[model samples]
Target: MTVKDRIVEIIAEQAVLDVSDVTMDSTLEDLGIDSLGLVESIFAIEEAFDIQVPFNANDPTESDFDISSVASIIKAVEDLVKAQS
Candidate 1:
């Protein structure tokens, strides 16, 4: 599957939402993802792609934590997948 597909799958699985509920602009908050869910999703992403996402508290909008939209999440995963390749 493509990175976007994988991201959507992750969001669906982690957020406990239907695949159809996920959209490119859908935010985690919109999907009812709490802090714990967010952390779980991050861990799932890390394990799925076998990449460690660096943390940066100074930048709350960093890709790893800034899962404001499905597009952004997909971009982050794509970057990690590319890096590993």
Candidate 2:
């Protein structure tokens, strides 16, 4: 699967929603995902892509990783993957 497809799957699983239900504009809160769920999702993404996400659990707002929207997260992960390559 493509990175976008895999990310959508991961986030959809975390939100207990179908992949079709997760859109690029959707936010974690919009999907009823709490802070813990977000953290878990990040861990899952890191493991799946084998890339370190620059997220700070203690200060998420201060972190470099953007989690504001599904599109942004996908872009960030793609960038990280490219950097690793």
Candidate 3:
């Protein structure tokens, strides 16, 4: 699957929402993803892509590193993928 597809699946599984409900512009809060859910989703994404997300789980808001929107998350993942390549 593509990075975007993987991200959508991770969010869907973690947030317990349908994939159709999530879009590039959908925010985590819009998808009903709480703090714990966001952490879980990040972990899932890390595992799926075998890459570390540059955010502190303990303080998601610190340094504005937390990904609030699907588009931002996808962009971050794409950057990581590109860096690895």
- TM, every model: 0.84, 0.97, 0.88
For each candidate, what is the lDDT?
A: 0.79, 0.96, 0.84
Comparing candidate 1 with candidate 3, which one achieves the higher TM-score? 3
Assess the local accuracy of residue 30 in candidate 2 as a C-alpha lDDT between 0 and 100. 100
* lDDT computed for candidate 1: 0.79
Report the C-alpha lDDT of model 3 over 1-85, residue by residue, as the tens digit.
Answer: 8999989999988778899888889999989898788888888888998987888877666733448689989988889878888
Clashing pairs in 3: none
Q: 2 or 3, which is superior by lDDT?
A: 2
**What lDDT, from 0 to 1, does candidate 3 have?**
0.84
Best by TM-score: 2
Each model's RMSD to truth, in Å?
Answer: 2.2, 0.6, 1.6
* TM-score comparison, 1 vs 2, better candidate: 2
Error of 3 at 7 (Å): 0.4
Q: Any residue pairs clashing in model 2, and if so which?
A: none
Residue-level lDDT tens digits of model 1 in 1-73: 8778887898899888898999999988899887778778878888888888764535647536456688987
